[model samples]
Target: MAAAHRARHWSFGGVVLVVTAALVAAVLISFSGSVAPRADAAVAAQTWSDEFDGVAGHAPDGAKWTLETGGSGFGNHELQYYTNSTSNAALDGQGHLVITARKNTDAGLGCWYGQCQYTSARLNTARTFTQAYGRFEARIKIPRGQGIWPAFWMLGNDLGTVGWPNSGEIDIMENIGREPNTVHGTVHGPGYSGAGGLGAAYSLPGGRAFADDFHVFAIDWSPNSIVWSVDGTTYKTLTPADTGGKKWVFDHPFFIILNLAVGGDWPGSPDGSTAFPQTMTVDYVRASSSGSAPVARPIRGIGGMCVDVAGASSADRTPIQLHNCTGNAAQQWTVGNDGTVRAFGKCLDVAGGSTADGAIVQLYTCNGTNAQKWTYTAAHDFTNVGANKCLDAKGNSSADGTRLQTWRCTGAAGQKWTLG
Candidate 1:
């Protein structure tokens, strides 16, 4: 799973409904002080009841996170020397995790290649707090000036077994000082990996940068989908179909990591206009499960385009065609807890599994296969279980003449299908 293989299949629909805006605004307002939720009048809630409780305002107390140090360069032309000791990384008492990069006069004892001048910390939950599906968020205020790139992200816990993009990378929040107001959320995996990986940038309203205040950046991950949100409002989604015909790398467990880099190819270096030793103040970090519940029902296709099965055919490559209606395994679908939808034991797959329109739909083995993963968008559209291709008719043909196929989504109602 190379990072470039995670490129998203782009599509634009009507403006997202503003329904979640009010709720997000309220959460931001309530986040001013400690993020404690009100208790019932009869019973007092615990102090850490909020999502980020316990993990904020200091170096994580529990053994859930490990701080990585040492002068090992992380491939980036960074100025700071990474140290494993807590001396350089600690709670500033003002409620900020300070990871300072200072120019040193003598780089003798702490030197890596030779005279190393700076030292900072990289924290990770690689040994603790690995989770599958849930909502993850962090509220942080960043330091200003150039050459600063801060990130809050997750890596598949199976990194040792799978490696790199194959293990998957979920970047929940990433920002460079130059692009202050614009934050990125990305997913990197094999096939769609690299600079154009599956990702999107969310800009603050009125061109506001996130450095001045604490903002909530989050991601809602389910078996079949990954939704990126800012302040709790979903702005982007990535599905299996978006990555061609690969496996859905998100079903397994992943651990979190947070770091502030001095310079990188993406963020570049600080010029004369840049400032140094910038800090990213994290108010808190939190993770939660989707809660114990039964899997949701699969959406059924309607509008008289149901496939009609005449009789039992050979299991190998048996093709079923769309007709009036016929309740059969070839037509009926069963969505599994792992976010895969199967019919006749074959996974539902997009034609050529391509993001382009008119791609036919087919069935294949599940196998944690990415093409079998589908995402239901708020617009009631079914995107490729791997990529973002929409389940569409060959054209906008409502008549029987239109062939059922997958196409690059235009976000039309005809392309919308209900997952019953």
Candidate 2:
């Protein structure tokens, strides 16, 4: 059945909130380290990877991930008791990490609420691997049943200190068995956590269930944007503008997690129609970065000097000059998605709002004004939206003290700039 998944909320006493949200907020907190490979700034590279190839019926590599074991509803009143047993999670020797969920009729101390009806495993790269900006991907075939939930997600690296709703959460792939044809990708932060999270879903075409085959789920995360895709088809792209003026708090590192949950507020409970011993098979998991592009970093020019703000000031009309690249905030510029060059939260502007030839360029508080917008061309010309002129180095001088001004687009060497 093809349908849409809506965020659900629950009420207890006088408080109306989502059970799953409370579970995540009240529980799930950690911080650790891993010897993960670092990504380069230019060109894409595989930073961290796991093939899940090991002896049959054995646990996954201890150097990559560790099991997160518990049964306390996992913050969502889940019926599964998570254990470190190999029966619940292991490598199949055939190049796959297999997570199996079974009906736990065996009594004992396994259950979180009353008798445990199911058992599963949760694996996390908390202290083993974490990254800031990169592409996170995994290929897997999920289980199908009434109450099975399989997810590959991430939490901010500061989770152990700041806690949920503050640490941020990114759901790269989440599939409830009830919606076998659809998988969701969501991000949760301050004002947009829990039932208020912002996200989108991708469903298989032709009414096909995702459980019928292995599919690639991935997210390409950059400075303030994230793009989601399934099987190489991008379905959603989110940015700070999507948030309702809330803080963009995902500008830090995060860790990975993979788990098979049984019976949660979203998927409900396994009933008579459900089968036993369902499994989610993961062929591999990898994280990569297209390296750091110039747009996200400070821009440099001739003489190896950085585009600087005069005196490192935040005042309007501060001269935008070329200075020794110190890698300071004053010299750090961001080519915003809005087409403005920003430094210290201010936009690069033309002094006195002039359009005349030789008008000096300066830094001003960003106000979305035309003077603040610039369009960079492949030829390395910075065209000001307000003056409709090109940013040029006076007299074609590459000297450090040469002043910067607006001039006609002459395609001259002086007007050309290169991002470093």
Candidate 3:
């Protein structure tokens, strides 16, 4: 997310890394296939961690985080003046980092609007640590108010050189007080920054507000993809193919940030419904990277064509078929941790949610049902749950437009598949 409204459309993908263009291009091509399912044995090792294990009423570990002091609205027309003072940010003695936002009408305190009306704290790991690919997570309990905006996110490490969007931004978690039950996870890159970012929201189940309790927010970042999740439930995944063919810029390291802004253009200013001395509590932050990188490749079968969505459409219920692989987004798929083979933000589904043989397989909204889940093995056989049938290329046809369906697993060539 761009900090300033005037620079909202700025691209964060500018700083080219030391990696060769060919290598980067290869990374993009590799995602057209399947992502190796996140293996339990291959769990990424912890690389960085902060458990908020500090004395109550003391500052956070100075070696891990630095307070960002400013009253410049943070480029979002924010009402808060960030300070390093313990009153705004400090350990709660309960093993939590409490970031408090209070009414600050003190004339001595300056703000872009002349006198600061609110006070908060923004902390970052800018100069201390940065990581390229890993799983970053935090467990947080946010504050509630009409205009309170709390966020846990990351910015590209090259921000010093390329500035805003050209350096990229990944918002792992963002919640505005007005939508207490909902939170957002978004990625900003060239051509899709600011309000145009590609993202999705995950609301608390049973209509519960997030501020009522602590929830884990995280992102599993890999070479060319990122998966966003809450409380271990994966909700969204993004890759280069989802960028409308724009440059993929999240190849290098990025630093983490956490802040609680009183008011901003998006959240507006806290009103009568809002209260002062609001605090956002954080339990911990952790980062990890896997020793074995997972492989992603296209599932090709019946005449060597890839399993594809008909017409490259994003519309629901589009028939999935055997088509000529052209490295387009339509053919790109990922085997997710939740047992789904997905593309275009949808899942490969059994039409009518049926369990009968010959059930048509199409693209549908991912609802985590048995019909949407598939167990893909090294043999390339996709066995559907509930239906208890295998994904088959009808009539063993290799021609484009040959619709795929579920049939009794014959172990035939039509059901057999290969990764391209």
Candidate 4:
């Protein structure tokens, strides 16, 4: 999605405004022995919105959006000249906004590749609105033709200073005419951007083209997580652990953007048979807010050590150990609604799906299997669903790198956890 990667990553964090060098180094060790819970709240309330109510031929709400006019390619090597004109974008008088891309040979606009061959519109809410974690979504019927591209995305508010990639970006939906039945959701950040962005694609069944109908595209974003869906089908989820060794840059506010480009590096150029007046119709767009920001505090246990991922590696099979509280992303765990305990984009899995007395716990890809599912009892026991065993500091020891394992439900100090 780097082709559309507006710029994006994450941790067990909530709306972080800044990241200094010290903070980066402290990722592994949480000082003060604070025991904090993994996460809280999902889509809470409607914080900001625009329903496109207006007369026909009117432009987008100027109070909420700023139309960006440029032909410098916007770093995408696109062909269209973005203009602030009603000719390119306007309300349809029926609760919908239509963004039309017209082939204009004589637009009389200065562009990176000489005279512009097309005209379209790009609108953003940089100055008027920004949100950190929430449900961001839109419903639209896309225009289809060779080289026609349309996107509903977001970029970090610190764009002017931090710049692309580092500023973060979340592409809720992007479609290229070449893939008539498909759309993609992506996150781009420092180590992962442009062509290397981490994301997934969704395609309509029955060989149906997205241009033939309006589809609901969205992302449910929270601390340390971003889930993407198309018409209610969840396709992908991203987290800080997915960025390799790079920083998770999605802890701040990001503004929304909607645009339709005629041609670009991703969709190529319009062909002779391509339609001239291609239109992208948007029915609505909305963002919901998160109630309480989730804190990825350390989970302290026996001897005052925290539950940790050995070596801070996100690779599958990484051991879950007992280490002196380090506030690093590797030690941060978020409790998923599905009863799965997660850290570094993976789940706390029973090794080999073992149901024995001494099976060690490890971080592995989250599958819906019972081995990866568990319930934290009121008494502080992390009991595995399938094995009916409780988490234990191996051999009741509290030493560093003491691997944790599952045992018969025990109320001993080794099995008790102090969570945030």
Candidate 3 local lDDT, residue 102: 90
Task: Estimate the TM-score for candidate 4.
Answer: 0.70
lDDT of 1 by residue, 1-420 (tens): 122222221101100111111111101100121111112111211111112333333554545456665554464445556565555556766545665554445446453346665556667765545666666777878655576777888777666555666778898887777777788888878765566578788889998878888888887665556767888555666666566677669877777777776655566666777655566767777775532211223334446465322243313234434554444434454443345454533456664456655666665433455666765556656667566677775555555434456667787756766543
Per-residue lDDT over 289-393 for candidate 2, one digit per residue giving the tens place of the 0 to 100 score: 533311345566655666777787766788877777777667766554345676654678888778999999887755667787887776668888889898877
List TM-score per model, in order.
Answer: 0.59, 0.66, 0.79, 0.70
For model 1, the stretches where C-alpha displacement exceeds 4 angstroms are: 1-59, 94-96, 104-106, 109-114, 293-296, 299-420
User: Order of all candidates by TM-score, from best down to worst?
Assistant: 3, 4, 2, 1
**In candidate 2, which residue ranges exceed 4 Å CA deviation?**
1-42, 293-420
lDDT of 3 by residue, 1-420 (tens): 332222231112212221111111111111323434334323446777899987899998888887877787766778888888999999988889999999886679988889999999888776566787767999999999998999999887766567667778898998888888889888888787877787788999899999999999998776656878898777887877788888788888887889998787888788899988899999999876633223344678988899998987766799999888887777776565456777765779999888888899998766768999887666668888768899999998888889999999998899987655
Error of 4 at 77 (Å): 3.0
Alpha carbon lDDT at 184, candidate 1: 82
Alpha-carbon local distance difference test for all models:
0.57, 0.73, 0.77, 0.77
Q: CA lDDT of 187 in candidate 2? A: 86
Q: Over 4 Å off in model 4, which ranges?
A: 1-43, 53-57, 93-95, 105-115, 187-208, 220-248, 302-305, 309-324, 335-341, 346-416
